[model samples]
Target: MIEPDSSGDRPSGSAPETTGRFIVVFAETEADPPAFLRSAAGLSNVADSRDFGHGPVDPATAGDADATVFASLGVAVVTADPQQAGALRMSSDQSNIESISPELVHHALSQGTLSPPSALFQDTEHFTWGLQATGAATSPRTGKGIRLAVLDTGFDSSHSDFAGRQVTVESFIPGEDPQDGHGHGTHCIGTSCGPRSSREGPGYGVASEADIYAGKVLSNSGSGSDGGIIAGIEWALVNGCAVISMSLGADIAQVHPPYTAIGRRVLDQGSLIIAAAGNNADRRQNDFGFVGAPANSPFILAVGALDEQLDLAYFSARTLPVRGGQVDIAGPGYRVHSSWLMPDRYNTISGTSMATPHVAGIAALWAEATGYRGRELWSVLVQESSRLQAPSVDVGSGLAMAPQE
Candidate 1:
């Protein structure tokens, strides 16, 4: 059953969707997860990631393996019976174990349609309103040396604007290719890494020269399980992406357990994950929705949506009264123009989904200009953002800005 958002239209504020499989987070110092799982949980059909040599793991490739261990993040996604799962959860051997959780189902954070906003910063012959509003249009940095990861529904490799760019594509979803079936990933990729000079309209991308790592974590239908998303993160880390942009999330207010550890671990490795704060609000109806899982993890940066006028988007979620649930930054998301799938080629959409990649692209620019990574990169974004008059719960440190020099 899909729970309705404040607008009584979109799904939000429900118990998070979950897959029956369990996620096991091992202690960071655990040396051999394959042996630990065998001795503690008494199962042996495990696929160790060290065998795959640090690339994205396709779940289908695991075949009959009962558990798949991501060695870098020290986590495993296990297909266990209730007895087996309960044993791992309730085990007295707590030395090597951290947390066990049901894998969650996440969706693309788009509103699925466009809503006309009162015009403020209009698109010009050279730039989209988002690029103009965030100062990305005039910023000198092109993120030339940075590597950015966009983990979502996938990317459109056939898009004309990206003809000569370097892009690495991988799919973590079983039975799906990395080619984008849903337009969300393509749109996000355009916002973050599309070309600076385009035959289409104005330039909509932020970090034009950054290497693109498109990881298809969500299925074509716009939903994904935690295992696939985690796999994407591992892939991004292994590939040395300086920033990871996640425009997908579960609409649960509570912080998800796995991401707390995963987020912290990824940052320590010098990569930052930036996620949409969520599109569950309806301010016209006076319901300011809370930030959702993955985004709500303290170690990950949460971004809310703002319009060309620099006010919070009506659908952009408000900060939940939790440590990591607060919106850390804002970006132009309402009716933002960016790349889409072929034939259509371009789209104008609204959501925190659109806002996330703007900050991500800007993050790449900062990564290039300042040579900052992980926590330092996160700090630079917060410290350099333009402060707005709205409450911090709605806009955080205000809008994310591009580096001028």
Candidate 2:
């Protein structure tokens, strides 16, 4: 669901008729508990009731059967203009019922993250990376010279685990890095560029020795859109990141312009932009019937997801990814462990969100080894990636083999 401003207006212009957003609505009877109504009704403040596209089921059937209800409603749903869409819009007769974006939702990501023990992943086996694909029993490159920028909600710089790691952080959204309040950014950073030292806690991160920048584009709830993402990319470039890892996705545009321009600049300036293929593989990333936008751009290394045991993941998108000569890669997404915000708990998060960082880390290691920059590192990355044996249009360059092996 999308949120409207306080006047119940959209962020910019009127919500486009093809606004590409949706909300669920339903009504409750007196017999139903008021608490449930509070939760469901709360959606009104952010999204506004008039914009709710479908449904008016009983509170009893609405809570657990929302999906079934939506399916029954079918494709004949009606969305509203943001200006007219504020809060609940009940009729005087109690015949009409609707829901809107929850007032408390504040952001997009549905769940808060759990924290990984800095000590638990102290060894290779329990860690996120033990060196990839280079054929060593362990990884050799520490990623000391690499600079990785994480574009997500925000980061928790105050954690002892991140003591000296943060260089700079800018919020495209209205928030602060110290407010890694959402936890997505924290986990993302831990994936690509967390420190390698044992004293830094045991959340096994990939480029343990690389410097980092936090580019907060998404809100604490993981909420974001194409605009913020583009802004984050520009910010990352200005900050001088060697690798900008985006563990997020956006709706693909039917039209294209300048998407390649920013990234090409990053690439030309010797930086790599690694992005998620998108979790919407099931929903369809766009009208082209495949991967999300920006990922479609030529300069990025788009990554798909895989399960921890190296199997193709359920969430990974299927696409014949090729931009110029660049063939994207895949990596572990599900059951792949990493740090969360809640202390002592490791998050088994999945999605291209989790997978993109693995590629960023490998590229960092490669940059460390070859002193390669710009398209040079990007070329090595594509060439060195594990090629698919029975590669499908869905699975790209097979899986990203453990970079250091």
Candidate 3:
């Protein structure tokens, strides 16, 4: 029942081009990735190859018979010869090549219409309502000793609130540093891994003591390619991050093969990838659209947005269950406040993008409290969430909550 978008028009503000000339070729579980590549080189031109963990293979000796077999996550990003690429796809170990597809683009899911702080009652930090609603405020566990990765634009390393925090950062965006120029990443990080409190406001963060691994997959302009995102995922897995939160996505109706594969692989490796369900819905207009790519994949946890009243946010996307993009959970997103780049260190924004980190931060707490990882951790989150009146199509298991312990 999952149908592809017939309208060729790309989502608004999305990058027009796909991930450049390179193509991603995934090796099947039983096949040896490096061995398969070496054998294929005899029939087709294999330029450069990169295996997870071992890094990039030398182009000159890529075809060496003794090449180490890529056993874990067995994926490779290769530059194929234009003439034989087609034949290679056809002849490549049909059993081993799980999928051959063009790398697509991904974007930060933040919507416009930034609201002023005064929109919510000023006496209390209404932005932190998400924390209170999820029981993160009272959770005895602080997500200590856990590594949580937020893959997005980047983090504002200069933010005073995180001055002494254990934050490790890496940038996948070409020619860009990890410093957050776009506020979206900073905001998401603020919610997931920020401290107890800041000078600008009360604590709006969830897993305050969790170690933060900010992976900048999107650039300052708030856009990036699938290659960058895949690389970021690999990095997170290599570093043993227990939870990977992605607040960025593209409005594609169909599931992307790469993300599906990556999501499964990450889960198998004991890491959970959480993504926004996107902010493309407008119930007032009666346009409840499908969840976006990456998130649409059944393996990734897709989250929807709610408002201060715990009602579904007007813009929160609902899953087309027939299409496999069901909302897995919900969190406060409308006019939510969080840290921004310095000088103006705080701002309020809305989107499923904002809601995703709330689940992530709470996931960290659950992980720390229950010692659960990967799919087990995912199950605990859904089982422990506060069920709301909303349909599963709109809010899945309902609002994600922090562990009571």
**Cα deviation in Å at residue 137, candidate 1?**
0.5
* Weakest ten-residue segment in model 3 by summed lDDT: 1-10
Tell me the tens digit of each residue's lDDT in model 1 across 1-405: 111221112235865666666678887778898898887778779998888876778667775798999988898988877567656765525667777766777788987465544448888889999898888999999999899999999999999899889999999999999999999999999999997667879999999999999999999999998999999999999999999999988899899999999999999999999999999999999999999999999999999999878888999999989889999999999998899999999999999999999999999999999999999999999999988867899999999999999
- Weakest lDDT window of 10 consecutive positions for candidate 1: 1-10
- List lDDT for all candidates, in order: 0.90, 0.60, 0.80
Against the hidden reference, what TM-scores do the models get?
0.71, 0.61, 0.69
Regions of model 1 farther than 4 Å from truth: 1-119
Candidate 3's C-alpha runs over 4 A off are: 1-127
Worst 10 residues of 2 by lDDT: 68-77
Q: After superposition, how far is residue 280 of candidate 1 from its true place, in Å?
A: 0.6
TM-score of predicted structure 1: 0.71
lDDT of 2 by residue, 217-313 (tens): 8888778776777888877777767888988766563213465776688888888888887766553334223466667677777787755445555
Off by over 4 Å in 2: 1-125, 129-137, 175-178, 196-203, 253-256, 283-289, 320-327, 342-345, 390-392, 401-405
**Which candidate leads in TM-score?**
1
Candidate numbers, best lDDT first, in rank order: 1, 3, 2
Q: Please give the lDDT score at residue 34 for candidate 2.
A: 25
